[model samples]
Target: MATTKKYTAILLLLVILGCQKQDTVDNFPIMGNLPMGEYQVGFQTLFTYDLTKNAIPYSDWDGNLYQSPTSENGRQYQINIWYPAQPDSGTRLKYADYINLMGRQTNFGESEEQKTFARQTFITQTRNLKNIRDTENKEELNTEQLNQLLDLDIFARLDAQPAEGQYPVVIYPNGSSPAYQSITCEFLASHGYVTVAFAPKGRFSSGMEISTTGLEVAVDDLEFVLGKVSEKSNADMNQVSILANAISSSVGAAAVSRNEKFKAFISLEGGFISAFEQRLLNGSSFYKPENIQTPILFIYSPHPSIDPKYTSHLKYADRYYAHFPKISEFAMLNYGMFDEFIPDIIGAHSGNTKKGFETANELILRFLNQTIKGESGELFDDSFMSSRNQIDTTFVLPSLPKPPNMAVLKDTFWKEGFDAIETIYQQLKSEGNPQPFSMNFYTEYRDWLAWKKDEDYVYRSRLYDLAYDSYPKSARINYYAGYFSMKREMNEKAKRFYRQALSLCESDEDLSASEKSTLRTYASEDLNSLLK
Candidate 1:
C-alpha cells in the first residue's frame, strides 16, 4: 500500500509538470518572434491601377463573380511595401493591423459595407486553413486561441518615416494569404531592403488559375509592380531581385527569363522543383531557362521524392540549392503557429519551426547580399553551412555549351542539297545529342525551306519529312507535312498527314487557339483536295 501511494504521487507530479510546460510554451508569441536586423521596419499600403490593361471581372472564393458598383478602367493592384525606416517612438503595428489591410485590398475606394464583408471573408478563410500542415493531421484552433494570434505584436511600424538611402528592391509574389511571408518581408526590410508583395490574381478571376494563361497573368502583375517600384525615389531599380515562394516561383522563373532587369532570383520552397510544375513551365513560351543569366538560390526542405539533380537544367545561371532537414514547405511561412507547433503537431522530422524560420531568413539575406549587393564574403561557403547541422548546400556554376552554328545548317542545305541536311541530322542523332537544336529550330528551318520551295519540291518534302519524324505530335509540323506532300503529288500521304494533324489538334492542349484554327483550316483544305 505504501509503494502504490508513492507511485501515484510521482505520476501526479509528472502530469502537473507537463501541463505547466505546455502552458509556458503556449504563452510565447504565436509566430515565434524572429530577431530583427539593424534598421527599423516601415510598412505602407498603396493602391494603383495599371491603365495599359483592362480589369476583368473577378470571382470570389465560392466561385461567385463580384459585381462592382464603380467602374474599373484597368487592372487594379494593391502594393504592400516594407522598407527600411527611421526609428520612431510610436507604437508598432500589431498582427491584427496587417490582417485588417486585406479587407481594403481589392475594394479600396468602395463602400464600408463591401470592406466589412471582405474583412470577415478574409478572416474566415484564414481560419479555415487549419489542415494546411498536411492532409492527415489537422490542428484545430478555437476563437480565443485565434484572437491571441491576432493580438500578437509584430515589428513593422505603420507609415513610419523612410530611411534616407537607395536600397535594393525585393519583389515577392504572395501565395494564398495577403499576409503571407510577412515575417520574411519585415526581416528583409529591417536589413535595408525595399521588399514589396502583392496579392496575385488570375486574369479573369480573383483565384489564380493553374494554366499557361494564368502564369502569364501573374508575370504581368509582377512586371506592373516592378514598374511602380521603379518610381520610388529610394528604390534602386538596377539592383532588383525577385524572392518567390511556392507557386510564385513559376512566375519568378518566367519573369527572370524575359526581363534582364532582375539581378537575381530566389525560390523559397519553389513549386517548379516538382515534375508537374516542370511540365507546366516547359509548356509556356516565356519559360526559357537558357535566358536566365543571373544567379539563383533555391531554399527547400529535403523530401525523399524530390531529386535535386533536375535543378541542373538552368545551365546559364550560377545556382545554389540549400536543403533544410528540419522544416517542411508549409512551416516556412508564418501561419501564426506556436514555436513548438510544427514539431509537436506535425512530427519530429519537422524540427523546431522557430529555428527553421530564422535560418531560412538568414540564408536568404546572406545570398541576396552576395548576389545583388555584390558583397564579397565566404558567407555561403560549405564551412558556414557545416556549422548548421540542419542545412545542406550545393553550388552549381554555369555550364554553357557552345551553341552549334545553326547558320551552318542553312549554308550546307544550299550547297550540298537535302541529302547533306539528312546526313548531319543522322550524325547528331547517332551521337545521342539533341541539345544543339530545339524544336523551334527545326520548325523555323522547315518554314524557310517552304519559302524556297519554288527551287525544288524534293527539298521541301525531304525537310518536312525530317521535321514530322522529329516532332510527331506537333500539329503545325503535321499540317505542313500534308501541304508539302500534296505538292509532291503524293495524295495518299497528304491525306494521312492531314488526318494526323487534326487528331493531334483535338488531343493536345498546348497549341494556341489561333494555331489550331490555322492547322484545321489548312489541313482540311488539303484533305478535301486529295479526296476530290
Candidate 2:
C-alpha cells in the first residue's frame, strides 16, 4: 500500500517470505478451555495424513507448498479439536504452553526473539491493566492474566462426555490472513459441542486457498476432514456446523448457499461479498453467492484495516441480503466498542475480548441451539428490530425501519442532482474532452469513486444533495446532513434536515441498530438546540 518505490519493493519481497510455511506438525494449545460453557474443555491436535480416495487429482491444484506435485500421501491437514472433558480429566494446561505451541505450529516458526517479544509484550500490558505492579507476583500474575484473557482454567478438567448421547460438531475456518485461531473453539467445546478448527499454526493453507482453485481445494480438504471426523468416538455426525472468520466468510456463505450439508453458517465479520459486491479498483469479483436455502447468521464489525470514517459495516449485511434474499439473520456490530474490547489485538477477525467475544458466542449458541438442536426462545425475538427496546448499544447493532424503495429527496430534484456528478465523472474519463470535477474529487477518488455509495456527504454539499436525493430515505445520511448543516450555521436548513432525519430514521430500514441510535441521539440534540 505504500507509495514509495523502495517501500513498495520491500513489501513485495515480504509477501514471498510470508508464503514460506513450516513442514512441522501443528502444536495446538493446552489451555483450560474458555469458561462461559458448562463443560471444561479438553483439546488435542489431529492430522488426516492423506485423502486419496475420491480426491481431486494432485495435478489439478496450482500449488502444493507442503508436498510434491504428485504426492502419494495426498493432502494432509492438522486439526485442533476441543471437547467436553470429564470432570476427572487430567490437570489443566499452562498458557505458556499455548503460546509456544502457537509459535512453532505456524506456517513458518517465529524467531525465538519474535516469540519472546510477544510473550513479554502481552504480560507487561496485562500486568499494568490488572495493576499487578508488585515485582514478586510476576509469575503469579502471568498465569492469572493469561487465563483471564482467554477465560480458561488451566487446572480444570474437561467434561469429556456430554449428558447427551454424542457431542455435536463445529468446523471453524480461519480467514485469508490466517493470523489467529479464534477463542470460540474453546468456548464451544466447553459447552458440550465437539468444536474443531484447523491448527492455529500448521494447517492454515487450506483455509488460505481461495485465490483461484483455492476454494475447491479447501472444500476437498474439508470434505476429507469431515469424513475422518466420523472416526472421533465422541462426535455426533448428525448435527454439524461451520463458523467462518472474515474472508473465510465468503467460503462458508458460498457453501451454505449451495447445499444442505451445514445446519448453520456463522460469519464473524465477513459474508458473501463475492456474490454481489465488486471491488471497483481492480475490477475483480471474489466469489459468487449461491442461492441455497440453508440458515445463516452474521456478526459483522468494521475491518480493522479500513478507516471507519470512510466505511460503515452497516451496509455489508444489506448488500448480501439484497443479493441472496433468503438470509435470516444479520447484525452490524458497532465499530468503536468492538475496538475497545480488543485493544491489544487488531482486526475484526480476532473476536478475542471479554465483551465482544462473549456476545458473539452467546448469539451463536442461541442460534445453534434454536435452529439446529430444535430448542426455542433462547435468543432475543422480534424486538431485535426495535430501536427503543434494544440491549446495551455497546453490544447490539441498533435497527431502524427500511421500506423497499423510498428516499428523502423530492422527486423533482432526484434525477437532476445525481446526473450532475455522473456527467462530471463522464467528462473526466472522456478521452476527447476530459475535465476535472475539481482537483479534489479527481485525485482523492480513485477506486472509491467507482462506488457512489461510499462518497463523502458532509463536506461535499453536492454529494450530500445527490445522496439525499439518491437515498433520501436513509436515516444515516439525513442525520449526517443535519449535523453537517448545524455545524456550518445553516440554522433553518439544519432544522429541516434534523427533523427529516428523525422521521426518516423511524422508517429507514437500511440503517442498522447502531446507525439508527446514532442518528436519533444526535438529531434529538440538534433539534433541541434549535428550539432553544
Candidate 3:
C-alpha cells in the first residue's frame, strides 16, 4: 500500500510537468468579442503603401492644400492598420514610421532635417538638396521626390472594430497628414462602422490610393473601395457614409453626390471649397449644400482664423452654412493652448492638437453611432449650433493620459528609482529574499503622476493601493493611499494623509510599455510555476 501511494504521487507530478509544456505551445490567445479593443488584422499586412514609387507633391501653396503633380497617376496606394492585437497571439507588429509611405526607398525624416543642416554646413557651397541635381540620376528630383519627402505611417488601434451585422462603411482619405487616417478610422470604428483609410493609388497596396484630380476622382475611389468592402460578408450594404479631411473633404462630398447609398457625409476642415480657386475661399463641388440628400457633419478647428494656411477653410464653412440650412452638424473645437505653432516652434506644440484630435474623434464616433445605428436623442439634432453643443457628455474617458513632458522626465526618475530597484534585483539574483515591493512602488508613483496631469481617479486609485501593499517603504505610499481614500469618498483620511505622502515621494515612473511587459511576464511565469 505505501509503494502504490508513492508511485501515484510521482505519476501525478509527471502529468503536471507535461501540461506545463503544453501551455507554452498553446500561447495563441482565444479572444471573445468583448467590448472593442485594439486588434491588428492579417488583411492589413497583405500589402504596403509605397509613396516612393509614385511620388506626390505636398507643397502647401502658401497655406492652401498642395496637390502633387503626379496625382493623375492610376490608383495604387497602400495603408496598414495599426490596431490592438488579440492578446496571447505571440505576435509583435513592426510599425513603419512615416518613411514607409514612400515605398521602402528614402528616409524622408532624415533628408528634411539634413536639408537644414546642409544649408548651415555649406551655406553657399550647396543649395538645399532640393536644388542640387542628383549626380547619378542626372535630373532634378521634382514633384515625385519632394512628395516622398513627407510621409507618416498608419497604425490601427483595437478600437477600429466594426459593429456586428452589415454596417455602413466610411473611407477617411487623409489630407495634409498621413497619420490622420488612423485617428478618423478608429473614431468611426468606435461607432460601429467599417471604416477604411484608403491609401491613395500612389501609396502601398494596404492603403487606398486615389488620384488628387479634384473631387470626381476621389468620389470614384470611394465608390471603388466601398464596393470592395461591401463584397465582404460582414459589411452592411444598406447604410454608408464617407468622412474626409482637408482635400479629401471634397472627395467625400463628391462621393455622396454620385452614390445615393452613402447615408451621410462629414468634412473635417473640408467643404465645397474648390482647390482651383486662386485664393482658398473657393466654392465646393456641391452648389446647394441643402440639396445634398445626405446629412453632413463638419468638424473644424475653432481658431482657423489665426492659422495662416487654414484661414480660407473658414470661408468655406460660411458658404456651407448658407447653402445647407438645417441638414448639417458642425463641431468647431479648441485644440488647446499647446498646439500653438509660433514660427520656430513649427509642429512641436501638440497639446491643443491632441485635445482637438481626441475631441473631434469622439464627436465623430458619437455622430456615426447615432446616425448609422439609428439611435435617436437630443444628440442627433443636426440643427444644434456650434460643434461643442453636439458633444456626448455621458461617455467616460477610456484611457489615462501620459503628459507631453512625461518622456523627457522618464530617464531622470528611472535613474533615481529604477536604479535602486535594480540594486535590490541584483541582490535577489544572489538568492536574497527581497520583498516584491519595487514593482508595486514604481507602478504607484507612475500612476500618481498620470493622475496629477489628467485627474483620472481610477488609474490613480489602482496604482495607490498597489503601492501601499507592495512597497510600504516607498516614499509616496501615503500619497497614493490618501488619493484613493478620498477617491473612495474617504474624505477625512484623504485630507489627513495626502500632504504627508506627497511630501515624501520623489519623482515617479513614466510607465513605459517595456516595464509593464516585464511585470506581466514575471506574474505569468510565477502563476504557471505555482500551478505546477
Question: Of the candidates shown, which would achieve the greatest TM-score relative to the real structure?
Answer: 1
Per-model TM-score, in order, reads 0.70, 0.46, 0.41
Sorted on lDDT, highest at the top, how do the candidates line up?
1, 2, 3
Model 1: per-residue Cα lDDT over 341-382, one tens digit each:
433333234466667777788888999989888888865676
Top model by lDDT, which number? Answer: 1
Q: Write the per-residue lDDT of candidate 2 for residues 1-532, one digit (tens) a residue.
A: 3469888898899998778432111222222122356665677656445644421221111334432222235454556677777654544454444444332222233467545644554444334422322344333234544544444223223233333447889887652111134356665766678877663112334324444344544555566667778798788888888877544555555555434577766765553333222132112222322222345565554333322222122321212111111111111121212234333322222333434444555567767777677886625555432321212322223222221111222232245555545554445345332222222222233223335643444334445554465456666667666665666677787888888889888778656688789878879988999889
How well does candidate 3 score on lDDT at residue 203?
A: 30
Alpha carbon RMSD to native, model 2:
21.9
| Cα-based lDDT at residue 479, candidate 3 | 52
Of models 2 and 3, which has the larger TM-score? 2
> Of models 2 and 3, which has the larger lDDT?
2
Q: Which 10 consecutive positions of candidate 2 have the poorest summed lDDT?
A: 320-329
Error of 1 at 131 (Å): 2.1
